[model samples]
Target: MRHARNNELTDRRSAASDAKAALLTAYRAAKTAAEPSRSARQAERISLVEAREARRAERERLKHEEQTRIVTLAAQKQAAIEAAEGAEIEARNSAENARISRVVEDEAARKAERDRRYAARKSRQA
Candidate 1:
């Protein structure tokens, strides 16, 4: 009877140890199963952050390009206006020079004609 009772005690202890091992195994499996999902979530978060940063950088680059374009256009417009003004001034100067040249030519022609008539009259008188 004592031998049987000792066997029963040993059996209970063996069963308890088996239950503890099974619980530990289940805990490890649960943690292992959750690890992949945790890692995936972390990777997803990193990707999202990277994508957002990329978009921001692209926007900034575009904005900078736009500003540069605007400035370049403004400079070009200013240069064009200055060129137009210079051309106008040159045209006015050319017209003034032409008028002066015509006046000088007319005065010289009148003087030549008067001198020719006087020379002819002097010859006729002699």
Candidate 2:
């Protein structure tokens, strides 16, 4: 009877080990069968990442261009303002110079008239 019990226990243990081995083989077969689809899914994920990166890069490029445009416009505006101020200053200086020239001409004319009067007086006295 003890030998019979040992035989039964051995049989049960062997059957359980065989079932575990079968389960392991099934898992391996399923993993192999799904490998192609898994790799395809990974490829799809990679492409999506690449597309997202491309969009981000494009957006960054556009933003940079816009900022550059804004900077250029601002610089142009500043230059125009400076040019206008310079023109105004030149006009003011020209006006001041004209006024000074008129004053000097008037002074010279008065001096010449005084000299002529003095000469006439001297000739009359002679």
Candidate 3:
């Protein structure tokens, strides 16, 4: 009887060990099955991050281009204003020179007439 009981005890221990091994195998299979889903989720996250970065880069590029265009237009406007001012100054200078020339011609004509009349009077006296 005691030997029979010892055999029964050994059978229970072996059965428990078999059950534990089966549970470990099922856990490993479940983890293996979930691996592909986890990997797919990670890939999707990486793609989303890359897309967001591309959008941000594009926005920055457009903003920089707009700023450059505005600066270029402003520079052109300033140059045009300066050119107009220079033309105005040149016109004023031309007008002043013409007025001075007319005054000089008038003075020379008066002097010539005075000299001619004095010479004629001296010839009559002689």
Q: State in Å the error of residue 3, model 1.
A: 50
lDDT of 2 at 102: 95
Q: What is the alpha-carbon lDDT for the whole of candidate 1?
A: 0.98
Instruction: Please tell me which model should have the higher lDDT, number 1 or number 2.
Output: 2
lDDT-wise, the better of 1 and 3 is: 1
Q: Candidate 2, residues 1-126: lDDT per residue as tens digits?
A: 999999999999999999999999999999999999999999999999999999999999999999999999999999999999999999999999999999999999999999999999999999
Error of 3 at 51 (Å): 1.2
RMSD of each: 9.4, 4.4, 7.2
* TM-scores of the candidates in the order shown: 0.58, 0.65, 0.60
Global lDDT of each model? 0.98, 0.99, 0.96
1 or 2, greater by TM-score: 2
Candidate 1: lDDT of 13? 99
**Candidate 3 residue 9 C-alpha distance from true site, Å:** 30
Query: By the TM-score metric, which is better: model 1 or model 3?
Result: 3
Best-matching candidate per lDDT: 2
Off by over 4 Å in 1: 1-39, 120-126
**Model 3, range 1-126, lDDT digits (tens) per residue?**
999999999999999999999999999999899999989999999999999999999999999999999999999999999999999999999999999998999888889889888999999999
Cand. 2 TM to true fold: 0.65
lDDT of 1 by residue, 1-126 (tens): 999999999999999999999999999999899999989999999999999999999999999999999999999999999999999999999999999999999999999999999999999999
